[model samples]
Target chain A: MNSSASTKERILTAAEALFAQRGFEGASLRQLTAAAGVNLAAVNYHFGSKDHLVEQVFKRRLDQLNARRLGALKHIAGLQETTLEDVLSAFIRPALDLSHDGGGGLFMRVLARAFAEHDDSLRKFLSENYGHVMRQFTVEFARLLPGLSKEELYWRIDLVTGALTHAMSGFGIIQRKSDVSETSHREQTAEHLIRFAAAGLRAP
Target chain B: MNSSASTKERILTAAEALFAQRGFEGASLRQLTAAAGVNLAAVNYHFGSKDHLVEQVFKRRLDQLNARRLGALKHIAGLQETTLEDVLSAFIRPALDLSHDGGGGLFMRVLARAFAEHDDSLRKFLSENYGHVMRQFTVEFARLLPGLSKEELYWRIDLVTGALTHAMSGFGIIQRKSDVSETSHREQTAEHLIRFAAAGLRAP
Candidate 1:
């Protein structure tokens, strides 16, 4: 974080790195505050609790990521000319782009942890707030693929999400070549993901 | 567990359940022993330490799962008429079938956790021991679809594994209906996964 960044920004930045490394349950507030260069009272004053801080860490990125996705979707949704590939790009690009943001890459690992942790309260929090973004995308997917039953679409969407989470968390067998710049690699990832996801979504 | 089951079997069974619920770091030997209805000495005796026990828990299930996957792949390797979907079924079916085994459902969550954890030592262990299964499958895939480059094949396989891990962990929105029996639900999941994956692997 820049020196000008506030106490709240510093805390969230440190929390994302710690949570990515040590997981939410594993990372203590003392370690978190110490890493942030802030004291315990400052933490309490900024985020209310560790639980609240975790949510803020997620909200900071997800809010922008989802917003970009929805904005992209808004351009293509219900257009007769819109292709499956286009709809997929709207969904996949924003998430992959997050990996390039300064120190924002670890946030993907944090998101992957949320999926694996099976923490009931955290999931409920996600579903209640950001679930609508997915719901909207599914509606658009339904429009383009009229033959698929709602159940089938959900299966595809859920699996596609799995692949995205799995790959975006940097667990894939493929690695970026040293010669390729990060931006170039991100675009290739988007292209590869969009093609595979579009094909999976349109499977007979 | 049955009284006839050995102490090693009992400890392994209980360990898988605890590790599934709480992660490797989160679950303790004491809680694991208490759950298994065995003494602490049994844990030390059966598996030297918590880390070794964790590896054993993985090996017990993964050894079986990979053997089954490779066995299926071997049958179709040089067949004159096997379709891409057939090759995929060989890979996907056995992993999904694990869910139907007694107390085996939670193991998928554990596997999913392993992916998200990003622990270097554990990943190297998986790649060293189990990576060959995927490598063999990839060679078969390459012969069948000569159009895709090696890099492309790896990317799709990685994503498909992600989707498979994501879906099999019961994290998807699609759930078994009340009318669907365990056998029927499992079958449907296999169908959905194989179809989606085959399409994904063969994407243009």
Candidate 2:
């Protein structure tokens, strides 16, 4: 059991890097297994197939992301003192933490690729499995901002998520300064995102 | 000269679709050439090489996007009656038009992938070539939003672009309904995005 768990960990780690660099089709199973320091049979034994492996890669990170977000939301949900920034922080902080931490930095790139690819199956999987987290957040947002219509609220939330994904992808520009500690940088990032998002959501 | 131009056009069109679907490295020259209904020699002869062709694919659409943005900006630059929405319409309308239109629809996906890749050379190319356009927009946004500090202004602008890219990619959801004509839908999109972005930029 111990060996099997470690082997799965190794494959996932290597797959994230490879998928981030080479994309889904570009990173063949041979290269994936090789990068993981495993063989063809090992990958098959552990994950069944490459398709299954891709789903697992997303599941590993997304489960962490959504769980963190829901946990943060639950702590403050429906509270008398909850502000928009508080809920924004709940949504944004966990994502920012994921991208800056050592292992999951590249996971954002994977998510970005999935977004760009617009793969139908992947979209369905995400909605079916993880859509509830977003729905719960939307409910909280609506409750907080009682004035905005449903369509209007959804539009703002969509743009907010867009900004979140774009920032996490580490796109064309934007970076942390060398003078700051990682934790400090993340704190500032969270502040900036939540502030910007809160203002947008509350916009007339 | 006409034949040559059309050949180049074909290669670019094919390249954009392939790159959007297969990504940069995953789409081979052989496939690109075949899909274009041109010979391998045609690609090398026209674009110089595969890498150069990749740049050309981005350049073609980016040049159009920036030109439209600048043209719109020029019309209203320093005009007395311009509202924030007017300036934003100039900035965003062309992009929404690009995606809703047939051919350039895939270009957003390409842009998303390039952003995801975080490729140093491509990033440099973009900033060097098109940086002036963004700088001009920033100056205008700063003028309109005089209260925001330079650092704060830049941070807000960065997040705004992130959201813009995310929305354009059409990842999973948030699409136009069949009942809404594309033009009306785009108009609404522009309104939604500009309102949200204006508020974010003005965040306290």
Candidate 3:
């Protein structure tokens, strides 16, 4: 049982790295097994197939991430007026903090790649597995911004979610070119994203 | 020369489709050449390498799109106190219009896939090639929103760009499941995005 657990962990670790380095089609089972120092049979034994492996990698991080987002939203739900800042923090803080967690950075990159890649199977998996989490956030957001129409609320939430995902992915389109410290850049990004999102959320 | 022109076009069409479907690393030159209905030597003669082929596919559409954006921005610049609508139109209309143009839709899908893929070489190529276009938008945005600091502008633009890209890619997370027509959805998205972005841009 102990050996089996270690083997499963190894498969997951290698799968995440491969998925991040090369997308779904680019990362083959042979490469995955080799990287994990396991046999092909072991991959099938642990994860069934590449698709399952990809799904597992995402589920590992996203399940926790969504829980945090929902938890934060629940904490703020008691307020009579959900300030833009409160809405922004509940969504952004969990994501940003996740980036700093163990292997969370790599997972962020993988998630970014998944969205950007737009593979049909991956998209289906994401929609199926995490659609409820997203809907939960949407429900909270709707309550927070009660004045906006249902359609408007959905659109704002869509844009806000897209922005948050893009920022977390490390695209760094806004990163300064000079020899600035990485810590400073992270702080700047966090502050800027929150402020920018707040403006978007509160816009007339 | 006539043969060469047709060959180039064929290669691009094939590359765009394959790249969109299979991503950069996943799509092989062998498959590309075969799909293009050209011999291997023809591809080598025309584009030199897979990377060059990828670059050419992007450049074809991006050059035109950027030119249009610049033209719109220039027109807006000539007017004093550009309205939120003007700024939003200048930023988004070109992209939406491009989607309607011939072969432009494929390029959009490919561009989205490029971001989602894990090829560093391709990512670097895109950033180096089109980074200036984004910077140009940023400069104009900063001018329009004098209330926002440069950092704030970048952050907002970053989110705006992400949402726009997500929409362009047709992920459709905001779609209502109950008998909603696509045309209405498109109109709703465009309108909602503009309002959301304008609010964000105008946010202090």
Candidate 4:
């Protein structure tokens, strides 16, 4: 990568860790810059402002994560043979994979912090940029669970999303055994989440 | 109420709002005292320290919440006639009720912040004080869902806890309609959570 790209990458990486550790509001620009080994000017030059930097931090991961989810959903969304489990796996596996990725786990913590902190602008940024991903998945979920009213469907999806976010953020007790490979552990997590969510969504 | 008791109540109420708005670390003692309209010595006199104050904030709500939950669970737990929905309603209804209680809703947001922030001592405090509530519920859950392995049971329970926490914190999109009464809204919420959680727990 070019020097500029590398610097931005470094800032993003350090910012993710600090943000995960000390939240969006708690982590100041000076601390973030010092951690990144970049000066305040570099942060300003690259990301423009702390709020923008926060947005970039989310954008970098979510853009790719949502794309993978959308791609996976497209493969089975409306197909006759598509089971609820298939739809759930498409939605869940990518997030589990991201949680296992280097620094990606930290990002989940940051995302959880975002959920915890009711910063309206950050929320709007997230909804504006990534709302469509959730909307599309909801569409497929609606098609599958035709008996559910729109309100009921939204509630279940929200609950499922919460569960998935919680699990992926490592808030659960199911830590990977030392013997299990990352891939295997992630696969197990996806299986567990998909099974539980499918059943929850399919509730009468 | 006596002067001291009223003062303590004022501090707690203000603390809950500040903590919910700005997290535990972010909300300073000064801000807390100012918000409470009390002096620093008053906080020290009542709670001893900010950490203890934070604990008190949780205790104020969780004590009552857990007591109600355990009371609800006791009525149906281990009964042969107790369905999964019964157990789930036991676990969920109190939390839903809490979200509607005056200043109780803000406490849920504070609880979500607790989940987001990886502060070990606070977690230890919660787990030590309130862990039994979960353990008792798990016992009842295990008795009902004999098909699930111990590990599987924990996973589902964790997911259910996450969903409930997320929803109660008002993170989900399920706002009460203007036509709905507070009691009605809470009832509907409990129903949604109980149904979803019961189905998730009973998953193969």
Which candidate gets the maximum DockQ versus the true structure?
Answer: 4
Residue lDDT tens for model 1, A1-204: 455358899899999999898788878899998998988777778778888988999999888888889999988765769888888999988898887787788888899999888778889988876889998898889988999998999999999999999899887878899999989999999999999999999999
Better of 3 and 4 by TM-score: 4
- In model 1, the runs with Cα more than 4 Å from the true position are A1-5, A78-80, B1-5
Q: Please list all clashing residue pairs in model 2, or write none if there are none.
A: none
lDDT of 1 by residue, B1-204 (tens): 455357788899898888778888888889988988889888777678877888888888898889889888888765778888888899888888887686677888898888877778878877887888988888878878899997898899899999999999887778899998989899999999999999998898
Per residue, candidate 2 scores C-alpha lDDT tens digits across B12-76 of 99999999887888789899889999988998898898889989999999989999899999999
> What TM-score describes the B chain of model 3?
0.85
Fnat values, candidates in order: 0.76, 0.74, 0.71, 0.75
Q: Per-residue CA lDDT of candidate 3, range B73-126, in tens?
A: 889989867876787888788887776567776666677777766578878888
Write candidate 3's Cα lDDT for A1-204 as tens digits: 999999988888888888877777778889988998999899888878777888898988888888898888888877777776776788787887778677676777788788766678888888887788778777766766778887677677778777777778766566555787656766667776777777776667
Q: Report the TM-score for the A-chain of model 4.
A: 0.94
Task: Please give the C-alpha DockQ score of model 4.
Answer: 0.78
DockQ per candidate, 2 decimals? 0.76, 0.66, 0.60, 0.78
How high is each candidate's TM-score? 0.94, 0.93, 0.87, 0.95
User: Recovered native contacts in candidate 4, as a fraction?
Assistant: 0.75
Which regions of candidate 3 are displaced past 4 Å? A29-41, A78-81, A174-191, B28-35, B39-41, B174-189
DockQ of 3: 0.60
Expressed as tens digits, the lDDT of each residue in A133-168 for candidate 2 is 999999989989999999899889999988888777
**Which runs of model 2 end up more than 4 angstroms from their true locations?**
A28-31, B28-31
Better of 1 and 2 by TM-score: 1
Q: What shift in Å separates residue A53 of candidate 4 from its native position after superposition?
A: 1.3
Q: lDDT per residue, candidate 4, B1-204, as tens digits?
A: 498899999999999999998788778889988988898789989989888999999999999899999999988855769888888888888887787777687888999999998888888988987899999989989988999999899999999989998999998877889999888888888888889999899887
